[model samples]
Target: MLYNLFNKVSSMNKFAALTKHFAAAVFWGCMMAVPGWAQSPGGTEKELIRLQNEWATARIKGDVAFLENLYAKEFRITAMNGSVVERDADIAVFASREMKPELITDEDMKVSLYGEVAVVTGRENLKGTYKGIPGEFALRFTNVFVRRDGHWQLVTHHSTEMRKK
Candidate 1:
């Protein structure tokens, strides 16, 4: 009888050990499935910065297709003049050649990551023309990006024209 009891207890212990390992495996599997959970901070930051550079290049080259793919459907921008423009409207300006951007450069860009969201703050120097009026401006800008479906998309952009001191 004692031998049988010992065997039963040993089986139970083996079952418990297997259960513990299974639970751990399931937990880690879920974590891996979460978007951006496995990305290192350094890698993510570099990717975001690259995206920002791509955005500038797209603007300069007037690549409407790239702009359309980079910005989310709900994307919005608050211009230096405090006017808010939706994604379609903003794209329209580029599509229609209403806003000609000669140069768009980002400087002092700092990126902050929050799980699936990132915020980039920086200074932008722009040499461009709007409505046939040539202009040069220095601006401080904030760009918000969100990770969705394992990719990042720009969601919001706000910029203020810097005053010359």
Candidate 2:
């Protein structure tokens, strides 16, 4: 009975190993079948950050159309305070706010790329007035961009404000 049980277990192990290898080959084959899009990491990273900077400038200028063009159709923004805003709502925030011509200066910026996706992370000092109300926030912002159809669009964004020590 012991010998029979060991033989059965060994057969099952062989079957499992065979299945694992088969699945791995299928996955690799599918990956190879997928076409690769031409993504330039150097220029793309620069363009994406430039686009985000332009978005902030437009926000200060209260230009919704510019913001609209800068963002992807399905943009998701999350504030440091855990507040979430979608594409429309994000553009609306700039439209509704009365801008007093301010500026966002990025202190430190880092850009990284993976395939067709690029992420830009930076610390920015923002100074502005909204609706005649004085406002200032030091934000660490992350902007994610994707290259699609030979165009880079802002896909996801997040901002977190640090507490004063």
Choose the strongest candidate by lDDT: 1
RMSD of each: 4.6, 8.7
lDDT of 1 by residue, 31-96 (tens): 788655435788888899999999998988889999999999999999999899999999999888
- Point out the worst 10-residue segment of candidate 1 by lDDT: 31-40
Task: State the local distance difference test value for candidate 1.
Answer: 0.92
Candidate 2 lDDT over 55-91, as tens digits, reads 7688778888888877899999897779888999778
**CA displacement after TM-score superposition, residue 129 of candidate 2 (Å):** 2.7
Off by over 4 Å in 2: 1-40, 98-101
Best candidate according to TM-score = 1
Tell how far residue 54 is off in model 2, in angstroms. Answer: 1.3
Clashing pairs in 2: none
- TM for every model, in the order presented, reads 0.79, 0.69
Measured with C-alpha atoms, the lDDT of residue 115 in candidate 2 is 69
Q: What number of backbone clashes does candidate 1 have, counting pairs of residues 3 or more apart or in separate chains?
A: 0
